[model samples]
Target: MRSPHWKRRLRVVAEFVLLYGALLGADWLVTGGSGFVTLSPNPYGLPILVMALAYGTEAGLVAAMLSTAVWLSHGEQVAPTGDYLERLLGLSLTPLMWFVMATAIGEVTNIRTRSLRRLRRDRQAAAGDAARLDRAYQDLVDANRALQVRLAIDTASPGRVIALAAAAISAPIDQRRTALRDLLTAATRTDDFTCYRVEPDQTARVWLRGTAAGARPVVLPKAFVHQLDRAADPLSVTTAEDRPLLADIGVAAAALRGADGTIMGCLVIHRTGFATMGSHSSAELAEIATWLPQVLDLGAQPVAPAASRAGRG
Candidate 1:
């Protein structure tokens, strides 16, 4: 296969030959076969100028050289009819003009083309930056909203905290998990998390899951579950030793305990921004986890059978 560079070179050569040959044919016809390259206007210059403007300096130069070759091919008819020095000057004039014009026009065309491409590249870069800023602005808006929610809980008295928990528990059974997830998102300041419902067989099932954009879904590693069950408090990974144990599970996890103190479920936080993962948020997460089991327990209640509509029929 031929390279694109060679193909382009071949195409430029073909265009120069065809256009120059056509100009020669027209000049020959106009001069009644007196020959080409001998006319006052020197029609051969047109091909060089056209090629230069169309394909830049190299193409124009090639066309000029081709024109010179045509002049030589025409022999005495196109040759100078004068003394030695006069003949030498005449021979040089047409080729010089063609080369000069081709160089100037081709350089100008190249400069204009380069400027347009640079403008296009600048426009594309500006567009990309604007899109990124828009996304960052949206993230700031969400964080501000979550901060408001977190602050509301943080500044509340014991009575207010109890009231909020009561309100969540009183929500419909279907809406309970969603409320819990949203509450966690506000408290944690990050949406990348998972909630699990522990089955009777000691296996954890995905009761609810939430993840930020570009984040993978959280999967609770078995070792992480084992660690949560054994540890009385929430587990925070702050050392390399614990990292592998919680790999793919989350950065921290708290076991949801029932009134009897048996582990009923678990909440795993996969990621939270460094600014929000301090002692304050950690305490808030544990505090929220305490009441979460109460809300989770409500889901265990069996739903009443739908009322029969047979009477209407």
Candidate 2:
């Protein structure tokens, strides 16, 4: 029905012929060859409407012209006997009315088709944009995963090599201890190092200090625990107005945080000239600060600060 084929052409011809025949037969019955009234419906307009939708404006106009001829012929039989030109004009009015109506309907159908075609084009364009964005997002995810595979995390200190190796393995208490020491060694120029765990009871226990103070945990003062828990970054305080315990130790301090960002412990590196250990020292302290809690969680408690050749200065 939709194709530009012989069958389509045949369908149009058949419809026009049938519409003309039906109108003529209806005219004969309604007028009965003695009436002057048009009681029969103008059904030919329906066939013109169908052609406009099926085969477009050109086909509809053709149907309208043929139907108009049939309408004019029927009017001649029913219309009054009068002057030739006046009767001719009166008979032509039926065809003229039907032709104008069919043309108007065809124009409206053309407008509706154009709107539908434009809507389909817009939808396709939006779908294409969405697909492109999905492809770009997938590419970024794959690149990040590749970069993570190529990277290795290790300390800068030479003394910490065995500790890093030990921590890399699982199931050994000595390995855990070595890894914890590596946390101090990774920071910089260690003269002495200590690890303190923040207990649930709001007290701090110095788990290990220097090279060998391990018989019992040293419980810190209440004032020290209050200041330690609130610390946001690594510090080296030489002032009494702040944490005097850290000032007394003469070491730079950093917080050990878990994966979820909770501060679990503290590391104090006793390097000389602590007050002036400045930005470079602070960055080194912060870098090692990230690893201490992971080693601690693996049963690695700080043992002793081993002697080293490298100094942060």
Candidate 3:
């Protein structure tokens, strides 16, 4: 414990007086002025002992000194002997006794103070650690939410999936390239662009492409197509490079299936930013894919004579 300052000094003084008053009153009631000079228990010294133990050595010494002084002032009544040695012994011994008591009390106070300080420090450290863990937990939750959103967008529609596959196949032919470009653009919004496609053999493919006004379609190799093909649900590839590819190209593709569950062509579509493909988008895509075979069956018709001849040639 630190030494007591002036404020504590003043408090010690006040305590001394109150204790002295109580002792005086008790002495007066018990023995009137007759027992006042006796060396028995000085009730006034009790508060001093208590204060010394609570505040430490400095407070204890001050309380002991004050009690000694008060006892000495009442010396005449305490000692029957008018001898100087007797008076001296009484005065000196009383203070000595108070000092001993104070010292013992102060040691206990110091130990308690140290223990309390250690407990407080430990509690503070634990609190700080808890706060840090809470922040990390919140961050994880946010990341999970973002992932769910991305998955939705990636799997939203079979039309988009089919479109992406068709685009990859058509990109090499100049005349059909625009159709691929238009499909990719329509799949996602501006600023958040991604392109993905699948090969005719149902090998999933992905690429990065961007849209500009009246611009020709840009062709690039797809990344992580094998992983997508193996995944039962639509998945997002978030490697630093893959994220940019999805955002920039705005297209992705998957394999389309016929009513008999035979693999047909591929579907393709552009995606917006990371946030675009959320749970809702993925669900929509799944529903669309379920009905795709029927839609294609109804749309298919025989080619005209002129178109058939052109195709043969």
- Total clashing residue pairs per candidate? 0, 1, 40
Please identify which of the two predictions, 1 or 3, would achieve the higher lDDT against the true structure.
1
Worst 10-residue lDDT window, candidate 2: 304-313
The list of candidate 1 runs beyond 4 A from truth reads 1-7, 32-35, 141-277, 281-313
Each candidate: RMSD: 16.3, 14.5, 11.8
Give all candidates' CA lDDT scores: 0.69, 0.60, 0.54
Per-residue CA lDDT of candidate 3, range 189-276, in tens? 3423333334555443333344542232344343444434333433333333344444543344343444443333333344445565
Q: Which of the two, 2 or 3, has more TM-score?
A: 3
Candidate 1: lDDT of 252? 77
Cα miss at 287, model 2 (Å)? 15
Candidate number with greatest lDDT: 1
In model 2, the runs with Cα more than 4 Å from the true position are 1-37, 53-56, 144-313
Ranking by lDDT: 1, 2, 3
Q: How far is candidate 2 from the true structure (C-alpha RMSD, Å)?
A: 14.5
C-alpha root-mean-square deviation, candidate 3: 11.8
TM-score of each: 0.47, 0.41, 0.49
lDDT of 3 at 37: 52
In candidate 3 the C-alpha lDDT for residue 74 amounts to: 74
Over 232-310, each residue of candidate 2 has an lDDT whose tens digit, in order, gives 5566654334445675554567666555444456776655445436557766666566544544652244332222112
